[model samples]
Target: MVLFAAGALLLGAGTTSRIFALTPENREAQATGPLTAYLEGQGENGAIWLKLRNGEVLKGRFEVKVGGSFGAYGKSRGIDRPGAAYEGSGRAIQGGSPAFVDMKGPSGATVHCEVVNDDANAHGSGVCLFSNGAEYWVLY
Candidate 1:
């Protein structure tokens, strides 16, 4: 089973992944550069907390749709079914679905992410773009 419910992904799930800067300047300095940010999720949906070098923490949510079906997680992604499997949050997401994440930072900043998910194991990899002309590689 998969979980894509929405409310608060930063509530604490102890699951976190490191995101590296994909920028040219940051790329050359990545080995000794800043941590860039962090990415995490529960099921097909989760939140991104961007911890940039400027000591900024931007928060955002991620949603996924399988075969272009279903809607946002917070709206109608959590389809309640009886005798279903259990994984992550309490939502079921079809495997091989495309994921899109939208998160807003302070001062009109935003972070957008695109990920390819393997719902069976609740793990995925993708890329995230920050409004400040920064890009990051995401995995969790």
Candidate 2:
């Protein structure tokens, strides 16, 4: 079996598929359909694939741009200090970046996800908004 950091897919030459568990955000969608979503790193963009419990599948692609994170702001933090990082008041607010996802699901419906990650590791909790006016809590 292949493994990554904290279940995160280390974006290598392109051999990792990050998966996310989706929870319905609205009351009407709480009862049925659209369960999980996943992403596969492929260079600058990745393929976002989602499959519902009812057997319906949706195919889409997402592009990741590293922002407000470690590597992206190394020079700004401190070039002298090798491991210098930006710290906040509470643990809930750390100096990490968020990975955004845009998946076009079934019937022209779009899914937008914002996960806490460094582009390489697609891990964290976020939300996906379906174009059909449905929202879901996404955790990867």
Candidate 3:
């Protein structure tokens, strides 16, 4: 009886560990980005216009239809740089709440934004982790 009980306990512990183990799918799902979060909460039809830290303006329009997506177009005219067109796409990740966004911009730049506070309106804030080893505080 003692051996049987010990075996049962070991089996239970192993099962518990397996249940809580972080699988690849779970890891991907939990790794939501800020842009994804922002676009997800945009509802069926929503829009945002925000100013970047570099004084460039970004205007995004989100459409939840057609598999939930967002597109943005903007221009940056820095001190010496001529105005250049900037465009990007934000796609929502499946089964991600508060939304995880995968965003890709011009010149192959990408970032992930997770929407922490989504009022589902014209204003929101999130943290963006860029592909170029940079992070920024985003407000829209």
Candidate 4:
């Protein structure tokens, strides 16, 4: 009975890991879906604000420049610090939807944000997960 229980536990763990494993295609889909929605609403220039879980505030200005690239600068706590800019190029995903964006911050941190655009209410929220395990809730 003990051996059976142990085997069951191992099998369950393996299954959980497999289920949570993120492949490249899954990663792209996860990013692209929200990114495409956010950019479509942003037009040429837009502003976004993030309130970190730790009470830090980050304000970002986004610009869709020529060649289909995007750039952003974020100010935290009303202070403009060096290395707080983000820039990336936008690409279409499998269905030709503009959803994949590869952006890196000034500190070389990768920022992953998922946003839903709500123009009518003007109260859209999203989450930004950083490479350093820091997360922020974005309000746009």
Best by lDDT: 2
User: Per-residue CA lDDT of candidate 4, range 16-110, in tens?
Assistant: 11010111223433442222112212333343332333334333433322233212322222112222221111111111101112234444545
Poorest lDDT segment (10 consecutive residues) of candidate 4: 1-10
Each model's total of backbone clashes: 2, 0, 11, 1
1-140: candidate 3 lDDT, tens digit per residue: 00000001112212211000111122332343222222212233333232333333343333222322222211111111121111112322222113233445444555444332222222333334455555444433
Ranking by lDDT: 2, 1, 4, 3
lDDT of 1 at 46: 63
Which parts of model 3 have CA positions greater than 4 angstroms off?
1-97, 120-122
Local error of candidate 2 at residue 118 (angstroms) = 4.8
List lDDT for all candidates, in order. 0.46, 0.49, 0.27, 0.27
Candidate 2 C-alpha error for residue 96, in Å: 2.5
TM-score of each: 0.52, 0.62, 0.31, 0.29
Q: Which residue pairs clash within candidate 1?
A: 2-91, 3-91
Worst 10 residues of 2 by lDDT: 1-10
Off by more than 4 A, model 2 = 1-10, 68-93, 118-121
CA shift at 18, candidate 3, in angstroms?
Answer: 43
- Compose the digit string of candidate 2's lDDT tens values, residues 6-35: 123335565567666676769645755447
